[model samples]
Target: MLWPYQVKTVPSLPEDAVRLDVVEQRIVPPEEDVVLIAHRQRIVRGLRALFAAGVAALGLLVTIQVVMIVEDRSRVQPGLVMMAIFWLVALVVGYDAAKGMLKPLPRGKWSELVAVPASGLATLGCRIQWPDGRWSDALLSKVDPALAANVFGTQRLWIVGEAFRGATTFAGVPGHAVLGRVRFN
Candidate 1:
């Protein structure tokens, strides 16, 4: 019954918390295929680069505004206000992007059950659970109906965030990582 976008407090489980290190040790074998690991690393790096570019663009805009304001004292009032707003937005976006970049992917077991319900035109609702008693309900778009029909309860998925924030893809496999048009509803 967990909705994807609903932010609910997850009560701590009574059992010992699963440490990231322990999970990593158990999941990633020493002799695991280096190619798959390299691919995952590349995905992470690409995401980081995208975030960096966003931050840089924001920074450049702020700098340009500052220069404009400095060059024109008569138009300082509006420019100053715009600069303040831009700076605030840039800081917020930069902070969030940085946090995402720093977060490590956690290993978790995907629940065997998956629910796919039609929401609207070109949209499907999906619910997936984790073995640790966590659930994610998401709205997906542009997904192949055949693939969607077949994928439920089929593969072990790698999750980037607790509430399925970043991306979800089949782990330990190439070309199955990217699901189409995923959005937390």
Candidate 2:
């Protein structure tokens, strides 16, 4: 049954009472979808800005280097440092861009959806879908399990589920992404 109260959770929806089919799951009062969209937009904007800044900084560094080379003959110390910093920043930004490109963006009103199959596994850990939704990474854990038996026998499935719910990890998680449900395959 659809509840009017639930419909209000999704910010994208109009204030009028409405029922939404979120992904494949049918939520009674639709779960709040506000933060996901806002967070996703924020991420996209941040990445775009970082990319622009990185490019601009790199260009400035190059210009300074060129002028220094032409005028002094010997390399300028400060210019070299600045250029190095610029390159480092650019490298970081480029990596971020790659990750953003590879990861799938949030789909529909349910931005937290992730499908991780059993086939993708790791030696030291397990494999999980990346938040951007493009790739999987090894899950480093305290107790490494070789077979599914261990996962199921110990009820560690919950842990696995929790991990799946969380966004593809870089280092840790943020408050907004903390809410997620795990699906077993």
Candidate 3:
């Protein structure tokens, strides 16, 4: 994708920052988050119901479409094949969305992390951080240059996304996109 003129590396301030609580890198199952276990389970139960409703609606649509295409034909039609592919993709998405319905639990140890600031490397656009000795990354937005320059160094950033929505990633986060972005913190 091409960025328009004036694409920037840093953002403006507190207004643009996403306040992320420093969480421990541990494999926390939905049940482990004791505080919200019941809430999360309830959501999952509701999503399961939604999944059933979606399947019913999509199934009906697919059935009618298939009948219309094959009613007077000796062989399957292009529309039928297209509908097949569409349902296939939909099922895949539905499966993944189900998995994402549950939040992810990150597991591991965090190293000095100081090296992340020292060595600047970009992966698929997001900055990579060194966890202990291995490389790791997250769905993070661009950090303000001023914040990064301070002693804390990139303690915060801004990102737009939905948590527990992606099949595998848990969160479907977008890239670090911004406009002129020179407002006060």
Candidate 4:
């Protein structure tokens, strides 16, 4: 018989699935709510201010390119390149200002979890099967590089897990998103 080196679990077929009560509370967290946990909160006012500034800056760049085209057509190439680069920078900044993309894991008490990890490469994900036959996929995280390597290594290892979920939502909803913390037993 071939040795099994990986475990993959995807909850398919309604009969095999259980309710996501304790974690998602019968509903998967909204994708937007997940973003709140995953990104820094960007106030709308700041984004509006940035939007105004970006428009003016872009206008200036365009005006300079027009001047170059009239003065020396060939010299306009460098101006065009600069405008492209500036436009890219503006796009990234605008997106970040409008919505956060990088945020640390929120501070909270870790809750003990009984879960069977989805095994593979140095990746963060698992599917936990409840006693009632319900299974749910959770994303895993660990701050320590050493510990994460051990648990995420290629070799098989028994895993004990903890979870830190977002306790609040942007839209004032009661439910939250899950971020699993893991350790090898």
Which candidate wins on TM-score?
A: 1
Best by lDDT: 1
Per-residue alpha-carbon lDDT of candidate 1 for residues 1-185, written as tens digits (9 for 90 to 100)? 11257576877855876655543323333124354445456667876787677667667766766777789866555754676577668767766645532444344432233444445424556665645666677665655443354444353323332444455433222223332334553
Global lDDT of each model? 0.49, 0.43, 0.40, 0.44
Per-prediction TM-score to the true structure, in the order listed = 0.43, 0.38, 0.36, 0.32
Please count the clashing residue pairs in each candidate, in the order shown. Answer: 0, 3, 0, 1
Clashing pairs in 1: none
Cα shift from native, residue 26, model 2 (Å): 4.8
TM-score winner between 1 and 3, please give it. Answer: 1
Ranking by TM-score: 1, 2, 3, 4
Tens digits of lDDT, candidate 4, 27-145: 32334345434322343455657776777777777788888788988777775668857876876776764442233333332222345446543344555444456656554443233
List model 3 lDDT by residue over 64-119, tens digit each.
76786678556556665676567667867877746644443233211122213333
Query: Which structure is stronger by lDDT: 2 or 3?
Result: 2
Candidate 4 global lDDT = 0.44
The true-versus-predicted C-alpha distance at residue 4 of model 2, in Å, is 28
Better candidate number, 1 or 2, judged by TM-score: 1
lDDT of 2: 0.43
- Pairs of colliding residues, candidate 4: 18-134
Misplaced by over 4 Å in model 4 are 1-42, 77-80, 85-135, 138-185
